[model samples]
Target chain A: MPIDIDISHVARLARLALDDDQLELYRRQLGVILEHAARVQALDTEGVEPTGHPLGFTNAFRDDEVRPSLDREVVLAEAPEERDGYFVVPPALEGP
Target chain B: MSLADLTITEAARGLRERRFSSRELVDAVLERAAQTEAELHAYLTLDHEGARRAADQADEELASGTDRGPLHGIPIALKDNLCTSGVETTCASQILAGYHPPYDATAVRRLREAGAVPVGKTNLDEFAMGSSTENSAYGPTRNPWDPDRVPGGSSGGSAAAVAAGSALGALGSDTGGSIRQPASLCGLVGVKPTYGLVSRYGLVAFASSLDQIGPLARTVEDAIAILEAIAGHDPADATSWAGEVPDFRAELGRGVEGLRIGTVTELSGDGYEPAVSEAVASMVAELEARGARVEEVSLPTFDVALSAYYLIAPAEASANLARFDGVRYGLRVPGATTEEMMARTRAEGFGPEVIRRILLGTYALSAGYYDAFYGQAHRVRTLIARDFARAYERVDVLVSPTSPTVAFPIGERTEDPLAMYLSDICTIPSNLAGHPAISIPIGLDDAGLPIGFQVMAPALAEPLLFRVAAEVERIAGFDARPTGVAP
Candidate 1:
């Protein structure tokens, strides 16, 4: 694991704001984690096919069924912020 | 009645004997849940009125001798992911914050039919993504033993509720150790049913191929009892197995005397804290003393399986989560255009961790990187499976530390996602190999956190898994985690 990191790049990607203390903290922690990951990279996976899932079964599906459904009013009742029989959302776009 | 100490089995027995009614048990559990929720943050929603209504019906059914099964009149909680109709199934992410499944998950439906009352939906890491429950969009599910620490996740809430005696038994799903890790941290018996032993019809997908639903209880018998109630083929689920379900409880203590228990050299090594290692070591010794052969086996691929799991799980998650684009059933943000609505809905709905994994997964599965990452991961996965197959040929069951160490403080590994993911090192291989595993409390650490010893076996070897696990727990006795609060 490299000691150096492109903190600015990661911040840009994650939309995070990091100060010196935070950067140092993440750097130390991420380094150890990466070091551990580097050890895993050393294994002989030469002939081993990387497993996609523990259960080798693929293309699992549920039968199409019209089962008993939840009451709309009852389910809508648990919403923390609901109005007009629907979930209200905060603004997605900022006003100019 | 004291609510915190009642096991579901005891409550059910009493309910049947006419000593008490299910409504009374429901009230007691609700009272305990109220007591714990404020401090523990273990529950996201508590439907006390709903539970009472169901329990009332259960009482009426028992009075008429229409007893459902072992789970009749029992109160159990669901990890947030298992969708229950008329109940919120958030998976601890804002993206699905107000989401209610249109119908019950197959497992949820089965439990309800078995007369198990749905107590409440518990907390979890967002989308079952983190090892600790801290990543939950709402809040961390605190450890029942030490309020300052975490109940290992992503079923941490279910584990904590059982640990705190809020419910008798609960359902938790394991994908890369979600159930066992939390169960170990909270000191309970947690089982991961073989891949197809239980249907995954309504579990909100994390990694579809590896996900499984199982029982989390305070006792092996209780777990087996619950498994018996729920384990069966579901025509609804294509992956559901057609094999006849075994009577797990009847097989318990059926003589592990000659069971070929295999101890993985990779897990039982210096990497473990001396105390954690000692506890599992003692368990292996006890197995031998019980007339079992504990042989050392190799899972050389376990070293790199975590990396493969990380890649595969996230890659699958990115695809699985694409459904939540705000149009279908979840909270959607209206926009001037379709693409903006999709983008803004995801941006607003998904918590940080969910987005992080989506991005990581998308990157890994991106065209240029598919062969180098996801494809390679699949091949490596097959090799790990082969390793287990060969080892199982020589041994009946495999054992290891459920976790590398005991529960850490709540915020210990939160800042670094990679570090937290590595904590699944012992659990990922089983998921990779598609095997059945159980995490049973075996010992305690210096801080009094509980240690878990995991017993795993080849596919459909749950009966053998239980035989070995129950014996280990029977021998080790309970290594109590400090419950600073009284029920």
Candidate 2:
């Protein structure tokens, strides 16, 4: 099976910025990989259920209780951009 | 024997008998690590001062007659993907270049509780994505047997460190044969326990459903000792198993007599190197000679397992790696808007392979193609697991060559992603089925590189995997050591 996926569109969804060269390279490589993976589509999986988890585990619940978390200072220290006691980020929207 | 050459089991015994102190052992390993650093490039961070302090404390406790079991005072290496408190944990990617984890992974915490001292964090592929460690931003870890060849990755650094005697044993994660393949190429015993057997609390996620933490050691017994120290329930990880952890060491001496071993007809075939196939065949003959029944079995879906893995793993990876945005932790590139900042940060931080996987995964799980790609792959995964279940009814364990060939040249498979993916064909099925598997060195190939024999058993049957692996170790008697290493 031949695939003609939009490389730029996929990168947009993935939030990765790819230049023209990388987009071309990925387009070709993903084509080959998807072609190989297309082998599974030929099998008749009519009644077979999808295995999202191998161990068949379902939603795991625990006692509803608050627990001690990582120290605020330690957790915030790893942030790339931090303000006083909070993570700093770029504006959610550009100024009009 | 020199302290560097001692296995974890032997080192523990020697420490208890007063033949050597933990400080002496750690110093010996650190000295060897320094000697090999220029050539092997196996470590990302060497915690020399911390290791020495831990060793001094261990010696004090031992001198006071407080023994802390088998792993006490043993020095080991961790694959950089496992979090270490206040220590730099880069998954060999520039994306996480300066990130220092504030807490230890549950597995690392368990090792510390067992009184094991971590000497360093080893290298791996960027985000544990590639087959060869060449994808590492720091540099590739060269194979100890031949420096020109790849050590097999993304757990390459841990395997190379163990083979070179830089550390007594090490921890590595197997998403899709990362641990087993490197162990095969570098001449060591690598075990991937049943899914959920070991907690994934702090293992930097690669593929949540398929990823598992296991040990790589110079001997099966050492691997068993390391696995015992790390396996059990953890409320920190919801998927962690709640079953009782067994004493794997006690099952080591159980012979293979009357055990039914199945050889996968699909895996033992033409594409493999003659050395790899021959080694596996010879191991099978040895098992049969020891009164185990050997039979040929076929899992027709075997070939598709790799294809399904490529789809499923990458899809999950796309979701797991979403946390690496510029805001929370890791590298950040400034931009005018938040969206632009995220895109620039990811583009600059991630390597090409990681980007490629994210692209592929994103495409697979995207709106229009979800059912045709990710959904089909999940169904294929189900078929593959059922095939294993069907085959296990007639056989107690399944055997195969751990890898198709020995270590290839460093840059050989980097160009073609599919070719590198094929290197893991033999080991991927067990991961997909969520069973326990092990790779033990069978013998060296014609070029003097090692070939590995893989033994796989049912889920949570790690004791059986260890028992069979020990028998293979005895029969093969693989004692060859790499050249140009310290004694």
Candidate 3:
């Protein structure tokens, strides 16, 4: 399958503020990656089950038990911003 | 006082003999870490004070005749993704730059219970995203062998810390050869235990099913020692295995006599540097001479292993990383709307490689592409797994070159990501098969860089894995000393 990737798509998806030079550089690099990924797409896996892990371990579960929390003051000690001991969320709207 | 060169078992023995106080050892390692942290950039944090308290407490308990097994009072490090209560657990990304968990990762709790002192967290690829430490938000961990070269990653920091003698051992996460490849490049002994061997309860997700936490050390015994401390079923992780965790060190000294060794016929083929191939051949010869029968075997599906890996790894990563979107715990971006906030935060928080993977993985699993991409890849994974199972039936262990080549320059393959991804070619199948694999430094290339010997076994076959790796380490004379330390 062909990819319609140019530097702009990469820049937008990657959220990088790339200049023209970086765009070209990243364009070529991303192309190599996609091309290689294309090669991986060519294998024949007709009847095989997709193996996510080699060994299978079913999810281990623990009953939800409320535990004592870390010292709120100590927990918030590293916070860049806090309000009433809860992590302060960013204002929902951008400033006008 | 040079605990840097001592295996974890040896260090514990000395501590037990009261030869050196745990505080003294911790101080030594902490000092080396402080001195080299800037140059090597191996650590994300240095808990010199916290580690000292743990060591002093260990000494008090030891003097009272208590032993915490191998890791007790041993100073170690971890890739920051392994959460520890009261310690900053950044996953090497700006997204969680200062995130500290209220609970310890299951592995960390086990290590602490074993009397291990966590000196600090090591750096890694952002969310364990890249093949090089260069993707770490803090800074790249430099190769101790060649400062100009990178410590192979996504577990690069753990490998770097061990290689530079910064810590006695470290815990690293492996999904897609993270532990083994970095260990190979950094010349440390690293083992990614069979999928559920060690609990992954506190490890930040990369690819949930594929991610595993394991030990990285200077010697096979050290890796085994740490493994003993952490391998067990944990109620917190549903996937934790039910079997008994074997005493890895106990399986050593058998010398691989009469052992059935399978050599991957294709891995030793082309695409490897001549030096790496020679090292594999020389090491294989040593195994054969040591009374072991080594024969060539094939995993025809192996050729397609990497292809399946790319599709599967990223596809899972895309789903796993979705939880990081400006949530309650991590850094949040303020935008006019939630949609804008999501994009801004992910863009600002994730590194370039991370974004690329999220998109690639997301694309693969997205509508209209699932079958051709993820679905097809999942089926390939089954073939690869079956190939391993069949190969294991014929051979006790499978041996291969851990990596295709030795450590390259810092930015040599970053510009060409595919070239970099191909480095994990030999190691990825083990991950796909969810098998136990170990990498020990075999020899070096002409450039004096390390070449790793990889030994993999059927599921939960750590006993077999340790046996072969230790024998190879013994005959190959692959010591843990830093390259120039012989002087």
- The total number of steric clashes, by the backbone 3 Å criterion, in model 2 comes to 0
Over the stretch B216-283, how does candidate 2's per-residue lDDT look in tens digits? Answer: 99899889889989999999999999878776866778889999999999897777999999889988
lDDT of 1 by residue, B1-487 (tens): 4744666667767877788888888788888887878888878888787888899999889999797987888889888998888787888887787776768899999999899998999999988988889988898989888899889999999999888877888999998999999999888999998888898999888988889999899888889888987899997778788768766755676767888888888776656778888888888888898899888999887777887787788778888988777655676666665556666677677776676666556655765667666777777788788889889899988888899888889899887787688678898888877788999998777787899889898888787788877788789778364464455
Q: Top model by DockQ, which number?
A: 2
Summing lDDT over every window of 10 consecutive residues in candidate 1 chain B, give the lowest-scoring window. B478-487
lDDT of 3 by residue, B1-487 (tens): 3666667778889998888988988887877776677778889988877999999999999999898787888989888999988788889999897787878999999899989999999999899977778888887888888888888999999998888777889999999889999999988899999988899888999988789999999888888888888999886777888778776766778888899898898797678989999999988988899888988999888887787788788878777777776645677777666556666787778877887777677666666768887888778778888888888788899898999888878889876667778888888888888888999898878788999999999887788788888889889897645663211
Q: What is the lDDT of residue B228 in candidate 2?
A: 86
Count of backbone clashes for each model?
13, 0, 11
- For residues A27-66, could you state the per-residue lDDT of candidate 1 as single tens digits? 5554453344344445556766555435655565666878
Q: After superposition, how far is residue B443 of candidate 2 from its true place, in Å?
A: 0.4
**Highest lDDT against the true fold, candidate:** 2
Q: What is the lDDT ranking, best to worst?
A: 2, 3, 1
Candidate 2: what lDDT? 0.92
**Model 3 lDDT per residue over A3-96, tens place:** 6454465345433344567456545554555566665567766666655545654354567899875688876766555789786655556678
User: DockQ values for all predictions?
Assistant: 0.22, 0.87, 0.37
Per-residue CA lDDT of model 2 for A24-81, tens digit only, reads 9999999999999888898889989999768999878899999999998988989987
Each candidate: what lDDT? 0.79, 0.92, 0.81
